[model samples]
Target chain A: MYDLRELTEAVRTFNRDRDWEQFHDAKSLLLALVGEVGEVAELLQWQPAATVREDVKAGRLHTRLAEELADVLLYLVMLADETGVDLGPAAAVKLAATAQRYPASKFRGQAPERQ
Target chain B: MYDLRELTEAVRTFNRDRDWEQFHDAKSLLLALVGEVGEVAELLQWQPAATVREDVKAGRLHTRLAEELADVLLYLVMLADETGVDLGPAAAVKLAATAQRYPASKFRGQAPERQ
Candidate 1:
């Protein structure tokens, strides 16, 4: 229901309303990302992959997963946005660079970290 | 080695080189996202989560994972960019929405899908 610009506006208003922007500088924001990720990881901590899969299916996992994931994405997008980065075309270039770095024959059926 | 704007420019050039912009409309771009995601999944197909962890550590997985993940992210960023979306402010907005939807009291020690 929320398109990107409107959504971004709301976030700005929220920050200004609470005067949270000063603290949301790059370092703090990045730290927040780590913190949120920790929270997300906590959901799967001490749990087997099977349980994690089940939890996802049952909608019984931590509430922060989406929140944290979104947080991470939001930060990344925001950082890029603030820096005048255009995501769409930037990605296309990354893909090209990645293609050169990791070819399909080497990549096929490979895990993310492997390549 | 790449900042966001330069990366985006490279991507745009890559597309223009192939005259691919016309096909990069919202619909096609979205479909491309699906395809990239599928490639990422293929790395884990029939494999245990343990294997995924190992692959990530040892760098034994498909090359496409980063490529695809970046692709999905790229499309999202581009879509937002073209539409005049600012990542940082927009994300702040989403965080606010999410914070309201799921409070810390409800979020602690939970996996992503639940709550």
Candidate 2:
């Protein structure tokens, strides 16, 4: 179990120790996050879903996937920090709101219709 | 502070209860993550970085930004879970490796040169 706050503080300390915060404005962080996400997409692209899942399960792509996903996550956490958003609470609230919007009794086994 | 484990459990339960896991193959989840990231990029696109910082600080864009960012996060967490990557440790290791890659003694306040 990892606390998001702990990770955030680690990220904060990492930046502060290096004086790298100056380079991490919201826009740059967002772009970095997007680039990392694109890498992740590229990795999984053109592969069948089952192949991707099986490879991941077998740990064949584990290290590379872990690295790319970590980049996406760290950049995201940094961006949220720069923008003054408490990501954990925001995510919890969003999940609650989504639950309200799509009650299981009705939406079970059904994808919501495209808007 | 929020535990990534708790969030992961909540997400798993949410999908299980809805029987939505069947629809969340690795490729579909990756696409969903990409789409949410696009939404985040759209929200910040074309804004001056300083202006974005000011708007976020003043809470003018807080709700929308939070919602969009939260979506990105949830989808990401779900995808990571699907792939069996334990995100917290991966991120920690990645950050540690990055610290080694760009030692503050040499790189302080300097962005790495573009490759």
Candidate 3:
């Protein structure tokens, strides 16, 4: 039940408090988003896919992957907040397009080749 | 103004319509999220950081990166939806912990050394 609007407000407040908004334009935030994401990918690179699930169930998810995931989400939230993009709606719009492009029945369990 | 709750609802409905919910659990979504994130990272790998910003200003941001970002976010949003984690509020909570761990004045403009 958490709202992205609330989190975006929090990010705004957090940046305003530190005068860091100057450092957070759409471009910079995008770069940082990718950087955090790369960190997440790096952690998963060393673990087998099955092991990732096992680690989650074993309460060991936080050893690295979870934190990196958190970082990626944080930057993403911040970027969306800065750009005035309501991610939920933006995502909804994108999904609508995706659904049209890849009808569920056609692409079920299959990866679409990028054109 | 988009609610993560609303986006989560749409994802739930979308999957339910296609019976794709069986494919989306915490573990699988996590893997997919990282995969999308990796795709985002790959696009940025060849471009210098400055070029990324330049690309944005030139109105050419989405030849690859923006879609990849959207993909990463869609998976992330879906993962949070499945896990019952409210991303915005969850982000606020994590930022609080990060703020405590790395005070703004101490870590401003400096990446923290991973411990």
User: Which one is best on DockQ?
Assistant: 2
* Local distance difference test values of all predictions, in order: 0.47, 0.87, 0.64
Per-candidate chain B TM: 0.70, 0.93, 0.84
lDDT of 2 by residue, B14-102 (tens): 89999999988888988888888888788788778878888877765877888888888898889999999898999999999999999
**Candidate 3 structure lDDT:** 0.64
Candidate 3 - CAPRI tier? acceptable
| Cα lDDT tens digits for candidate 1, B5-88 | 444455555455544455444333434544544554554455553344445334544333444445656654443333234434
Top TM-score hit: 2
For A1-115, candidate 2 gives per-residue lDDT tens digits of: 2788999999999999889898898889988898898888788887777677887767557788889999888998999999888888998999999999999999999987757
Interface RMSD over true interface Cα atoms for each candidate: 13.1, 1.2, 3.9
RMSD of candidates 1 onward, in order: 13.7, 1.3, 4.1
- Model 3 chain B: worst 10 consecutive residues (lDDT sum): B56-65
Per-prediction TM-score, please?
Answer: 0.46, 0.96, 0.71
- Rank candidates by TM-score, best first: 2, 3, 1
Write model 1 residue lDDT over A75-100, tens digit each, in one string.
54443333234444445566777657
Order the candidate numbers by lDDT, best to worst: 2, 3, 1
lDDT of 2 at A82: 91
Given candidate 1, what's the lDDT at residue A20?
49
Across A1-115, the per-residue lDDT of candidate 3 in tens digits comes to: 2676666677676676566777776656767777776665564466565455455434544435546656677788776565444565567667888888878888776655645
Stretches of candidate 1 exceeding 4 Å from the true structure: A1-93, A96-115, B1-6, B62-64, B82-84, B112-115
Task: Give candidate 2's error at residue B95 in angstroms.
Answer: 0.4
Residue A41, candidate 1: how far off, in angstroms? 28
lDDT (Cα, tens digit) per residue for candidate 3, span B1-115: 2676667677777776666776775666767776776665565466555455555434544435556556677888776665445565566667887778877777666645645
Error of 1 at B29 (Å): 0.7
